[model samples]
Target: MNATIILVGTELLSGMTIDTNSIYMAEELNKYGIEIKYKFTVGDNIKDIVEVIEFGKDKSDLVILSGGLG
Candidate 1:
């Protein structure tokens, strides 16, 4: 299966926080024969987050969201 990972956090965008979630998830997903098609780091904006989700769903079989710690 194909998957997409979306990371939502201003801290991640700003580079203050290290993004380790995607790396870990990617490793785990690969074991199940899942491929991550797209990975995105979005800031704390509703409009942008929505846009990413909308676009991601069309191209990927699964969309996994992580790191939206507000």
Candidate 2:
């Protein structure tokens, strides 16, 4: 199945922190033969996050969201 990982954090976009989660997730998911089609980082903006989540859901069979859930 195809998957998309959405990393939510302004620090990620601002280059303040590296997004190791996506890298690790991609590598791990690859072992299961699940392809990660898209990866995105969005600031703590709800609208943008929702939009991206929706888009990812539409394009991928599975969507994994990390960080910024709080």
Candidate 3:
């Protein structure tokens, strides 16, 4: 299956924090024969999150969102 990974966090966009989560998830998904079609890093904005998810759904069979949840 094709997948899109969306990492949400201001620190990620600012480059203050490394996006280790995406790399880890990608590796794990790869084991399952899942192809990562797209990867996006956006700040903590609901609008941006919604937009990316909407876009990802059209391009991928699965959408994986991580981080930015408190």
TM-scores for all candidates: the values are 0.94, 0.94, 0.93
> Where is model 3 more than 4 Å wrong at Cα?
none
Model 2 TM-score (2 dp): 0.94
- Provide the lDDT at 21 for model 1: 95
* TM-score comparison, 2 vs 3, better candidate: 2
Worst 10 residues of 2 by lDDT: 61-70
Stretches of candidate 1 exceeding 4 Å from the true structure: none
Error of 3 at 42 (Å): 0.5
Which scores higher on lDDT, 1 or 2?
A: 1
lDDT of each: 0.92, 0.92, 0.93
Colliding residue pairs in candidate 1:
none
- lDDT-based ranking: 3, 1, 2
lDDT of 3 by residue, 35-56 (tens): 9999999899999999999999
Superposed model 2: Cα runs more than 4 Å off? 68-70
The stretch of ten residues in a row with the least summed lDDT in candidate 1 is 61-70
Which residue pairs in candidate 2 have backbone atoms (N, alpha carbon, C) closer than 3 angstroms, thus clashing?
none
lDDT of 1 by residue, 1-70 (tens): 9999999999998878899999999999999999999999998899999999998999999999997554
